[model samples]
Target: MSSAYNHARPPAGAASLPAPDDPVAARLQESARRMAGIAVFSGVVNVLMLSGSLYMLQVYDRVIPSRNVATLIGLSLMVLCAYLLQGYFDALRSRMLCRVATLFDAGLQEHIHTALATLPLRGAKPMLMQQPLRDLDQIRAFMSGMGPTAFLDMPWIPIFLIALFLFHPLIGFTALAGTVAIIAMTLLSERLSRGAAKTAMDLSAQRQVLADTTQRNAEVIRALGMLDRFTARWSRANERYLRENIRASDVSANLGSGAKVLRYVLQSGMLGLGAWLVVADKASGGVMIASSIMMGRALAPVEVALGTWKQLVAARQGIKRLREICKATAPPAAPPVELPRPSRELSVQNLSVVAPGMERPIVSNVSFALSAGMGLALLGASASGKTSLSKALVGIWQAASGVVRLDGGALDQWRNADLGRYIGYLPQDVALFDGTVAENICRFDETATSDAILKAARVAGVHDMILRLPDGYATRIGAGGMSLSAGQRQRVGLARAVFGDPFLVVLDEPNANLDTEGEQALTRAIQALRAAGSIVIVISHRPSALAALDMALVLYEGKAIAFGRRDEVFARVSNASRQIAERQAAAAPAVARRAAAFEGAAS
Candidate 1:
């Protein structure tokens, strides 16, 4: 166990990645630098894009009029070279964008996973816990697709328009009007579809939550004959999502169609205006055709931009959501202190905890201290705050007020991952990840040794039971240990709680699913843990489990009623109950006689 604990920390001189709080900004900065490089390449590509117009001009103006074969051949070769360069630059920019996306994922994936794991500690519902990863993928896809290229080419629109003006002012003015019209249509599309898009996204998230819940509880739904009800509920949610999605798509499609029509009109109008200019002797036939081509080129990015507007909008929303989540889940600013191994001293100083959205504290002003080699039993009825108190002790739930400390340091003083090395907890819900029994016993620590795994199983007395399986410790368990019986799951969780020489262990309802033999094993596990100089805290409703504990704390309505040696606290509680019973028994005869007299008089 000690060997496993010792190997958990990284070496002192190892290269450290950026802290979780810094990764979002660091990744953004890195991506921006890459985008800057791509932007330079885009400028070159746009410049080379004018090769076709120039080629047309040379062919009609110089080669055709002068009938010079040498000049025509030379111009064709130049145009070919220009197209080749443009193709190369375009491919390079696309590759750069893909690389930027990869870097961004590398920087943030681990941090997002860490936040998701710790979100329950903040009492968050985590309804969309996996959404951020999907959002990251969305951003990556947009960066590599035509959407970003459209934006990059947008600035070159004015350059093309300027070239058209030099050819003939009428052509330039006509093209400018078309550009303004397209811009107006784009804005209108955003205005009409923004609300629908947001609504659709929210509905989709709700549908995902419902689907996840139904899948996880398929057994319960089938057993209770609730399949039809769940299916109907999901169908309604999905229909709403589809309706809003179609509405938003319709608006976008209309705008895209309008932009395409306006683009064609502007191109034809430029040609007609150029012809009129030629007839009026303001320009030649070569200038007429070249000006139309330039006008069409100027408006191309706008057409593409309007066509991919939905992707741009979605990417914008994804960015905003990612920023908000990262901010909300950022770790504390202060670096954690590196403390020595604790001596198993547990202290709770006036601790209070209230459930989320509730005014009443579930555990209020509770204080206790236990030394090494001692075991304390918390005896309470259902909803008596035992589980909440246990959660606070192990640092899963934050205290509303006061502090819980190991040795002499408050829980928050140590880094959570570091503190976790010396503490273990078994929650009421015996959830196990999809893995082998050995992996679960070692808390899924990759560095854990086989000896440590075997020792933990032995301590929990689940070794023989594990061996009975076909693959022994190597047997695979399904998600949430669905493959195991309730008792087996609980026992495996117990082994996990005592895996690595932890100084403080808290088990809530440890024997809830255990049979007679299993309960006896649990008693021995507690005794062994105590004899090893560890502090053991057990929350149990059964009196038999409490027999092995040396001390007891009795609670009622979130208040501690008694705290002392087990026999003393139990005696006080029993005496108080006996007195109340005796008083009630003595008053029963008088009340009965008075009721009889009243009945006799009425008769």
Candidate 2:
């Protein structure tokens, strides 16, 4: 619930390990090569940028005095071609950048999605779960926007500077001074807006999380008259996000305005200097206008960069987060060793489970072994670690210290995808996806046949109920698909658990929302599972839920207080503590009465 989920960060000052063959990094390197190709187009575009100043130089210096119409027409045609080429190359570079963005995303988006799907099991915070996707989006946007072009154009600034110097030293130095000023402003904008960008990102994440939570619990909030309180919390978060955004925008806008003004002043100064040179017979009048045009071209990239400073900051932050995620995440095992299907037993040795952000273990120092064809009921009160133990057994929550061994191999030894085929679990709170009744039963397994789905439903005694629905097995049912009663949902969940005759099945409070009929179906499902030589574990406090279970484990405050044959455990533990008050009272009064009678006889 909080943002304290352990992300398994690498230790600081740890010895560096060998570099991984990271596909994301490799894709980026390929993108770098694409960016390099665009640089060649950038070079061609910059070269053709001289067309404007050159046209002005020719019209002033050559055509003005000569009064030759044919010469003017020829020069016009040449400059037109130059301008056309320049635009084409500029557009080409932008298109190439977009292609680069597409390729980069196409290669890594699937991997990023997989990482997000398993984030909860890896102990990721609810708010931060979407951050990696946000990072990918930001990077994609930057690559496809004007931001990349500005950065590309920056490297060609010296070309314009060289042209300006060829006009006059004073003009060159003035443009040079203006360039330094714009560069200084760029640096200042980055420094000032860096903190604002990061703060804004944090506030935005908080605001989004609040909005999502409110929507998900909208009915509950309205029922409980809590809308006003939730709105207040959302308002505070939204205000913080807006203020930080405004702060960042102001910095970039101001710097952009300042850079624009400086470019204009520098252009005028360069023109004035060129005019002086012309009058002094050191340069021609044509140089005056040409230098002014060149000055604008020279500083254009810097000005554009200043305008996009906020976007640049966002993209940089995105890259930083992406790197952190990649570094913190462990790569999946390659060609994971396949183990034979488990058929012997399910064993948990000295198991303890500590959830993320908690120092105390929810399930502690518990051990149990169940052979094939056995059924076990885990009995405990509220918060007595029944659910936690069930989750650990099903590999939903990792064991803090212990081994969940299927056959002789630990759960970790089997690949997750491969291990899932032999394990079935129904959580306390049933969550059905937005899919058909058959799809939900088959766990959305596209390869599952109709027979398997029907078998599971029949075993859970939900086959008749499902057939009564409007579309039978094809009926859509879920939060947005179709609403079902709580009892109906629980029975469907039971059917899902027994699909494919899984080797290990764990159900937590399976009968909590069921009717008497559903309860009977649950017991039958457990019996069928055990008959198939599957190890079945049920977590419940209701005795009816344990009707089909022979073995029992009693938990108290996270410890195994008693465990063995169901009748024997209850007998021993009950006789030891069940009637403590009545037994102690009778024994104490009898001893006192005997003492008093003896005293009376002595007297």
lDDT of the candidates, in the order given: 0.84, 0.85
lDDT tens digits by residue: candidate 1, 325-426? 777777664443488878958888999988754668999999999999889999887888988888888887788999998888998888767788899788
Error of 1 at 566 (Å): 1.2
Worst 10 residues of 1 by lDDT: 1-10
Q: TM-score of every model?
A: 0.92, 0.90
Best model number under lDDT: 2
Model 2 per-residue lDDT at 424:
89
Error of 2 at 414 (Å): 0.8
After superposing all C-alphas onto the true structure, candidate 2 shows an RMSD in angstroms of: 7.1
List, residue by residue over 1-603, the lDDT tens digit for candidate 2. 011112112245532433355646766787888899999998899889989999999999999999999999999999999999998888888877877887777656555776677676677877787888888888888888898888888999999999989887878888898999989989999998899889998888888889989999999999999999999999999999999999888877888898899988998888888888988999998899999999999999888888878878998898777766765664456334689889999989999999765779999999989999999889877999998888888888889998899997888887777788899899877888899999999999999999999999998899999999889999888674337778888889889989988999999889998888889888998998899899999988788889899898999999999889988887877787758967888799898999999999999
lDDT of 1 at 522: 93
